[model samples]
Target chain A: TQLLEQSPQFLSIQEGENLTVYCNSSSVFSSLQWYRQEPGEGPVLLVTVVTGGEVKKLKRLTFQFGDARKDSSLHITAAQPGDTGLYLCAGGGVNAGGTSYGKLTFGQGTILTVHP
Target chain B: NAGVTQTPKFRILKIGQSMTLQCTQDMNHNYMYWYRQDPGMGLKLIYYSVGAGITDKGEVPNGYNVSRSTTEDFPLRLELAAPSQTSVYFCASSYSASGRAYEQYFGPGTRLTVT
Candidate 1:
């Protein structure tokens, strides 16, 4: 079983502060995805990192995939109240049958609370 | 388009009771998934369907069953509800294509309380 461990199960920060969430795993993954979920709502995809050592940026959010594909991180710059939510990281890999598109194994999740 | 829709936003079930959670997607996606989120825990895959008439077990498929009879609908069934089954359920859909990645669109969510 693939397990992704996330740090800082809970985080609270004031507006304009920066924060980073980490997702580490012992197993390698073919791809990693980040999601943000709001109360009473399902998670929404924020980004997908397929290549090792890959980095992608969305506005003030930056995502990085580890060189060994065993870890990933989400960094929020100038965090705001709107960025507060449950952030999750999911890792995906192929089965022995070579079926690459499989269900993801998610991390424990990080709950971010930003106050303005 | 209503990317994904789940009916009966909330439900409460007693032990041994059975219920079906309805899910529908209008985007004609071939990949549909059912997941459950426990308190302070990340979502766990319950079941998934690659296409109509094709369903498979996921990470946590115990006590859950799913069916995909049409491209637009995939419903999950829980029989003999248990308190351990209480959680927020989400339905999601994504397009399936070789070498192409698609983001999944999720429904609001269904909060089920089992007593």
Candidate 2:
């Protein structure tokens, strides 16, 4: 079974502080996705990184894919209270067509709290 | 386009009871998925349908069944509800192309409690 492990299960920081969450796995994935979820709501997709060593920035957030496709990371600079939420990393399982089009396995998630 | 929608935002069931969770999408997505999220844990796939009339088991498919009779609908049926089955359920849909994975749109989610 392919498993994704996230570090620092819980994080609390003051507003404007920077933080990084890591998602690691021994298995290589075709693609990786990052999501942020608020309480009582379904997770919203933040970004998707498919190529190795790919980096994508969304406003104050930065996401990176490992060169080997076995890990990923999310970094937030100058985090605001609104940025506090559950961050999840999901590894996309490639199908027969070699695309990460089918099922996706998720990590336990990192709960981030940004206090003002 | 309404994206994805799930019925019964909240529900409570007793052991041995049965119920069906309804999911629908208006985007005409070809891939639909059902997942369950326990408290403090990541979501686990329960079942998925590639297209109408085609379904497949996911990581945690036990005690659950699904059917896709039409392109817009995918319903999950739970038989003999147990305590372990209590969790928040989410429905998602996506469209896949040749060699690229499409983004999945998710529903608000349904919270179910089996006592």
Candidate 3:
């Protein structure tokens, strides 16, 4: 079984502060995705990284995939109160049959509370 | 489009009771997934379907069942509810190609409590 360990399970920061969330795993994945979920709602996709050592940016958030495809990171620059939410990272892999089942192993999630 | 929709946003079921969580996607995505989220556990896949008439088990499938009879609907059934089964259920859909990764659209989620 594949497992994802995320660091900083709880984060509380004031507005304009920058923070980073890390997701590490021992198993390799074909792709990694970041999602942000608000209270009472399902997670919303933030970004997807498919290549090793790949980086993607969306507005104030930057995502990076490790060279081994076993780890990833999310960095928020100048965070705001609106950035408060549960951030999740999920790793996607193909089965032995070479089928991309779209099954994802998710991290425990980091709950970010950005005070204004 | 109503990317994905789930019914009964919140529900409370007694032990041994059975219920079906309804999910529908208007995007006609071929890949649909059912996952449960606990307090500390992020999201565990309960079941998934690649297309209509095809379903497979995920990491945690012991107490749940699912069916995909159409491209639009994939409902999850829980029989003999247990307190351990209380969690928030999310339904998601994606248009998957063979090797490429696609974005999955999720429903608001169903909060179920079994006592």
Highest DockQ against the true fold, candidate: 3
Please name the candidate that would achieve the greatest lDDT relative to the true structure. 3
Which regions of candidate 2 are displaced past 4 Å?
A: A98-101
TM-score of 2: 0.96
lDDT of 1 by residue, B1-115 (tens): 8789999999999999999999999999888999999987888889999989999999889999999999999999998999999999999997633343446778999999998
TM for every model, in the order presented, reads 0.95, 0.96, 0.97
Off by over 4 Å in 3: A95-98
lDDT of 1 by residue, A1-116 (tens): 88999998999999999999999999998788899999999889999888899999999999999999999999999999999899999887744454644577889899999999
Quality of candidate 2 docking, DockQ: 0.60
Point out the higher-scoring one by lDDT: 1 or 2: 2
Error of 1 at A59 (Å): 0.6
Q: Candidate 1 regions off by >4 Å?
A: A95-98, B96-102
Interface CA RMSD of each prediction in angstroms: 2.4, 1.7, 1.6
Docking class of 1: medium
